[model samples]
Target: MSLTTDLAQAKSRANIRAKARAKSGSETTPAGEASPSPRSRRRKHRERIYQWLFLVPAVIYMALFFGYPVVKNIVMSFQDYTTATFFTGEAPWVGLANYAKVLSSSLFSTSLVNTALFTLGSIAGQFVIGLALAIFFQRKFPLNGILRSLLLLPWLLPLIVSSAVWRWILDKDSGALNRFLGGLHIVDTGIPWLTSTSLALIAVVGVNIWIGIPFNLTILYGGLQEIPDELYEAGSLDGATGWKAFRHITWPMLRPVVSVVLVLGVVYTLKVLDIILGLTNGGPANSTQTIATQSYDLSFHEFKFGEGAALGNVLVVISLVFAVLYLRASRRSVDE
Candidate 1:
């Protein structure tokens, strides 16, 4: 009788356990729904972690290199960071005094104007010539590869080296350019290309254009190649050849690449220091003094680190504005 009672209690406990499991199943997954297994859930979590793991190196790199320098520069901009600070290890906070001093100076206006002119002229010349070259090279021809490779020489050469070569070429005396012009009877005497205030900036812009052309050509050519030939073939069937095809199809397709090239060219041209310093050293009465050169002068030459940091920050702000504008424009274009 006792054994029979124990069996009955055991059966009742099993029924309670089975009913609890059924209730939990209904509550958790409901009917017609399948719940994820623990193995699948863990696998998904592992996949997410793996994805983040791939990004860790890039995050750490940017933090250590780009982030720290930017933060340090910004902090230094507001302080009297100078040679004295190095010895004493004290950079006193001076609020906006550095910015005021930099902005109020007469040289700042000249540098700003020069920077604008240099950027605009270099970009315009580089884009126009580079696009022409890219289009010309798109056609199959003999020696095309060789010529393209040769064209990159100017860009591959160091900026200082290029500047030195250009300086010799543009020298007021015994220069290749003057001699060539004299031979052609274009001018009677040696032109002081670098010495003259009016001509110094022009010469620098021309050299920058020469150096930048190869980069523009390579990028634009790649973009051109990506365009399908079938589109051109179809357009030709519709009497869209030459200018008509370019205006209707090529221009529309190349617009995105052109925008990229222009923005990058502008940003690069803005902070051009080596070329200017190598060519003119912001001389001829500070005619070629750009913001970049000015910042270099302040920090290294004058030992005014705070003012230099301020100018550097200003340039960064300008670049950021252009980048933001490009992003907005790109978004709008995508939406449309």
Candidate 2:
């Protein structure tokens, strides 16, 4: 009886000691891991802060470079900012006056039409030719890699260089194009490609199309390469070959990439300035004058900084709408 009682007392004392120790010690995680110490937690937080320090420079750079300019442009759009304002620092508030003036101008209408034509022509020509070339290169040929690399030359050249080269090529007199045409006896007189009002915009669009071809080719080719051969083989079994195969298997699969390419092309084409500036300078009665070039002229030449900002914002709004569309397309692609 006494031994049994002593054993019970000993067990009770052990239980009491264990409970005391549990109360004094740190809590544990669900997996029975002891909680981290305060000092260790502080050290971990400090380490995380050190990791975030790497992004500080990028944040600052974006703020100073892109964010500040966009905000300043928006503010300037609402004020009568000009060369005079620059020196005197007295840009009077003008609300929507700048926008009303720019939008009502006949030049704005001409520029808007030109922008539409330039964008459409460039995108259409670039996409069609690029797709055709991409399909051709898909087949095996001698020096295929070399030729493909060389094809990128136009796109790889700097815009300024391309503009200068095209300027010489398109020069009505003593130009390579005119010389070639003369050799073929196509025309007795050289065609005024840049100097003529009717032809200058067309010529600008052609140059932009040429510059944009290789980019479309490269991207579309990559998209084509990603398509599974198994799909094509299966498609063939179903009597879908050649044109039919492309129409069904290839076209359906390539839609997402096509959407992305078209949107990006439109955005890029809208902002083109250097090529037009170098080739025509929006000359011959503002034939090649686009919103981009007009904005440049307004800000620098006419000293209408507020109007320039307003025009620039219009471009920005247009780009943002396309950007949203791109995001939705991208999301749909991901969902698929």
Candidate 3:
């Protein structure tokens, strides 16, 4: 009789549990709907609207500033427009005449070539030197903070100021560089650093490289610091040393940062103007002329505003192409 009573209690408990589970399952279901609660749905919609509201100001700003100017520049490139024509409203349509003139000009060709060379040389120099400095500074050394701060002086100074200082140092006569070289008997006479067509471009490129190095060093050093020390220790445990460790670990880890830096460096170097203007002014027989200076010369100096606009447009296209290529390459690297 006691056993029968225990079984009856156990059956009652199981029945109660089944009823409770059935009620819970019924509560979780919507009788005729296959969707979330109205409150949850409303919250998601609110979140999306909030996101768009946050983005609206930026979109409006771009349309007003960037989009408008780009369209205006394109229109100006097609018209026989000038500062005077703009105010007078008497410009005529030229339909690619300016582009034709720009393409045919020997000066434009030379400027493009010089721009390419300068960009490439400066980037290579800055990258190699910056990487070396970054690696060196990664080690714990005395006065590292002070040294790093001093190194940034080149990039921190105003561009015009840096260019002027370099100009004084590289001056053909009565320059510190010439005086030092002469004192050391490195050369019997002062070299004409800027007066010669051949040397002017080189001197300008050198100054640009000097200015860019500090920026590269700061970025790359920051990237290097973010890499974990444990990777190196792991490599050491595996009997990896020196180049092998760097090749297997550091290079892979740093690839993304390096790609970003290189792309940015290329774009910035290609658009350089202040250094060239302050240093050479595209003088010494126009040998140092770049697209930026050429555009200025055409529009402001010669009053060929349409042609100048065309040149500027070409620069924009080239820069855009390079940027797109970099982005695509970066994406591919990530995908692989």
- Write down the lDDT that model 1 would get: 0.90
Residue 57 of model 2: what lDDT?
Answer: 59
Q: Tens digits of per-residue lDDT for model 1 on 224-304?
A: 998999999999999999999999988888888888888888888899999999999998999999999999999999999
- Candidate 1 weakest lDDT stretch, 10 residues: 1-10
For all predicted structures, in order, the TM-scores are 0.88, 0.83, 0.87
Note each model's CA RMSD in angstroms: 14.5, 15.0, 14.5
Instruction: Give the Cα-based TM-score of candidate 3 against the true structure.
Output: 0.87
Q: What is the C-alpha lDDT profile of model 2 across 1-336, one tens digit per residue?
A: 443454455556656757865876655434533677788789868755754464465567678988999999999999999788978999999999999999999999999999999999999999999998888898899999999999899988999999999999999998899999999999899999999999999999999999999999999998898899999999999999999998999989889989989999999999999999999999989989999999999998999999999999998998888889999999889768
lDDT of each: 0.90, 0.89, 0.86
* Clashing residue pairs for model 2: none
**Sort by TM-score, top down from the best:** 1, 3, 2
- Which runs in model 3 stand beyond 4 Å of their true positions? 1-34, 330-336
The positional error of residue 70 in candidate 1, measured at the CA in angstroms, is 0.4
